[model samples]
Structures are given as C-alpha cells and as structure tokens.
Target: MKKLFLLLLFTVVVLVACASPYDPAPQLLPSYVKNVYVRPVVNNTNQYGLEDKFTKAIIDEFMRDGRLSVVTTEEEADGVVVCEIKRYVLQPLTYDENMVTEQYKLWVLINVFFIDKHENVTLWAEPNMEGIQIYADSVKGGFGGMTEEEAREYIWEKLARDIVKRTIKGFGSTGGISERKVQD
Candidate 1:
C-alpha cells in the first residue's frame, strides 16, 4: 500500500511538472510604439461627416485608454492607425399599427490597421471589423426609444472601445488567429 501511495504521488508530480501554460499569440505592437497618430477615417458610405465622427471617436477611445499618446500628425507619431469605413446599414425591424418603423438595427463595417512609422510595416490589421446596435423608435409614451443620433453615438462608442482594447492588448493577443503578419 505504501509503494502504491508513493507511485501515485510520483505520478501526480510528473503530471504537474509536465503541465504547461497556454502560449499566446505574438505581440503585434512592439514596445517602442509610444504615440499613435489617428488618420482621417475614409468614408466609403454615403453618410457625410461619419468619417469625422469615427475619427473623433477613435481618438477619444485611445485617449481614454491611456496606453499610448495620441498624436496629431504622422511625423510626431511612432505608429499610425488607419481606418476606412466600408459599409453602413440600417434596417427597420418592427412596425407600428400605422406601418411606422418602431425598431431598427444599425451596422457599421470598417477596415483598420496599425503601421509602425519607422519600419513602415503593418503591425496588425482588422479588415471587416463590424459594430452593430439595435434601437427602438420613439413610442407614444416617448420611452424606450432613442433618436438616430443617439444610436449612432452608442455604436461609435462601442466600436471605439473595441478598437482601443485590441490595440492596447498588443493586437494578436486576442486568442485568435490574426490575419495580420509580423515582421521577423
């Protein structure tokens, strides 16, 4: 019985020793990246001024994160974040008794990338990144409903938060296969 107990203990120790932690993906943002310059967001959709709104939102999020300083120009930045708005979709969901729209779904698609200015190489890119939100139209009671501007703000905030989170976490460390390639 003593021999069996010792064997079990040895087996446990061996198993524990063999256990290894999960290896995360490589860091996309190098440690030298101190300031990030947010370029003007290119707007592909017909929505005028959306580019400015998204650009402002992204800059605000980066500032809020405080991981990297936001620079005004590429010359002052160690890295640059380029974004292109690809699509904007709004779909009416439910309808009121008079055929009035009562609910809507808003979706925004964008392509974003981070480039190291000194090396002039892409650190990471999230093509086709999407943000979506659902909102109700103003009802008779004027409750549980939001205006289009309100919905837009909500979606923008969420997207900015996501972008900042992904950027600050070193890009590829998000526990998934990154489409962006790293330079050796």
Candidate 2:
C-alpha cells in the first residue's frame, strides 16, 4: 500500500512538470480587430502585375496568421492596412562578351501601414521592405528569352511567409511578451 501511494505521487509530479506554464501577463489583443480591411496596393513601379500580387500576398498572410479576422471591404472592418509597392525591377546579368550567362534578378520593395478606426492612429508602419530572387537562364536563351513568371510565383510565396514571421515577432516583442525555453 505504501509503495503504490509513492508511485502515484511520483507520476503526478512528473505530469505536472511536463505541462506548460500559464502566462501571467497575457497581452491584450484587440477584440475590435475582428475584421480587417486590406486596401488595394498602390504601385509606383512600372511592373504591371506587382500591385495585385503584393495585395493578395498581404491578405493571405493575415488570414494564415489566424490572429486577425480579415474582411474584404473597409465598411465591414474595424481597421485598415494599406500597402504600397515602391519598386519592382529586373536587372540583367551578363557574362563574357555580354553573352548573358545568367538570367535577370528581380527586386521588390514595399511599404505597409496599419490604421485604427476609433482611435485614428497608425498602429504600424514599415517602409522600404525589400526582397530579391534570382533565376538562371540557358546560354541559348538571352535574358529576355526566359519567362520569369514562375520564379515570381515561387519568390512571392517565400516573401509572404517571411513577412508574416516578421510581423508576429514584432508584435510579441512590442507587447512585452518574452518567450523562454525550458531544457529537458
């Protein structure tokens, strides 16, 4: 009987140790941000399709984060986030004799701002966020010969993920929430 009681107590202690600790200071997440407005991105670059692509990327990031309930229109949203595409350029890469050993490099620059409805304050502003992606081309094809649409697609996915990660990290840091790791 004594042995059984000791075993039970040990098991309970181990179970409790394995559980996660409850956060004492839970950050106040805005309940009013139940809906979000994603405005159309203003494109300053000559690139034709950059505006739509960047706009969709930001919306998708917000949706995937699961923290904010996103809405399409401003009328239904509590706040609005506006994004601008400042630059999109493709620079050619040339080798000996200007044979164009490699394909063009695509660079993208963006700016984002978030606004609150009731307080009428800008929550966040990130200017000059940039990303670069490169693709290779065959010798037979010149820089202009290879289509970079597929490359853009791949790069956009990665860029969107990075943007979300940065946003989350910034939120946590600014909210004064610290993450600590426990060793096994």
Candidate 3:
C-alpha cells in the first residue's frame, strides 16, 4: 500500500510538470491599416443593380468588424478598399418548351482590392468573390422563381456575411488582433 501510494504521487507530480501553461501574447493590428476607406463600388457588368449590392455588402463588412475606423473617401483613409461588380446572371429553368417552371439560380461575382495609402501597397486583391443562391419560381406554388428585387436582397445579405467573415479571418491571420486580445 505504501509503495502504491508513492507511485501514484510520483505520477501526479510528473503529469503536473509535463503540462504546459498558457501564455497569452499581445494583440497586434495590421501595420498598414490605421483607417479604412470604402469606395463606392463600380458596376462594370452588363447585369443591372449588382454594383450597388456588392458595394453595400463591402461597407457592411467594415461596419460589422469594427476593427478599423471607416472613412468616406479614399484620400482621407490610410487604407482603401475598392470593389467592382463583374457578373450577375440568372439562368432560367425550363423542363420543356410547353411546360415552363419557375426556378432559377442567381450568381454574383465581385472584385475586391485592399490598398495601403502610406505604403503605396496593395495588401490584397481578389477579382473573384463570388456567390450563388437559389430561389423558387412563384410565391403561390411554393416553387415560384425569385423576382429581380428578391434575388438582389438575398444575394446582398449572403455576400455581406461572406465578405465580412472572410475579411475578418484574413485580417486575423495577418495579425489583426494582438495576443492580448485573444480570449483564454
């Protein structure tokens, strides 16, 4: 019994010594981004209204993160985020010529640029931040296709969330927060 107790005590001591303590580091923000400027998104695509949707989404992302202060104009900001709508397409769904169904998929593509003014650097430029959402054809049949306005609303919300999440993760990986900011 004495030997067993000693062995157990020794095992506990070893286990305690082997365990590593958590040491939190200091939080750090991006070196180049002190202030962010969100430009009015330009729509260069043939599809109408996409430009507005993308622009609003990007701005919403900046607001949600609340990490960097946003500026109205690029000249006033330390970093500028410029975006463009590249494509917006809704393909029709038809089972046959005689019997047409109301269902469609909406696709949207946007280009995003993060530029640093002071450093004259382009931190990130992605030409393809794209998303797709499906909508039914008619409200009555429970299979109705999405109207243009409805599709816009759906796509905008989805794009905003996606852009916000991706940007936050990217910023974090690039040292958006200091070690001290990380919760235990």
Clashes of each: 0, 0, 18
Off by over 4 Å in 3: 1-32, 94-98, 143-145, 171-184
Candidate number achieving the greatest lDDT relative to the actual structure: 1
Q: Using TM-score as the measure, name the better of candidate 1 and candidate 3.
A: 1
> Residue 120 CA error for candidate 1 (Å)?
1.1
Across 90-178, the per-residue lDDT of candidate 3 in tens digits comes to: 87655445566567778888876666576665556566888787777665355455675788777777766665555444643433322
| Regions of model 1 farther than 4 Å from truth | 1-23, 26-28, 139-142, 174-184
Residue lDDT tens for model 2, 68-181:
777867777776777787888878765557574566687888876656665566556667877787766544564544457756665667666665554443433344322332
RMSD of each: 5.2, 10.6, 8.9
Between candidates 2 and 3, name the one with more favorable TM-score.
3
Q: What is the lDDT of residue 58 in candidate 2?
A: 74
Q: Under the 3 Å rule for N, CA and C atoms, how many clashes does model 3 have?
A: 18
Q: Which of candidates 1 and 2 is the stronger one according to TM-score?
A: 1
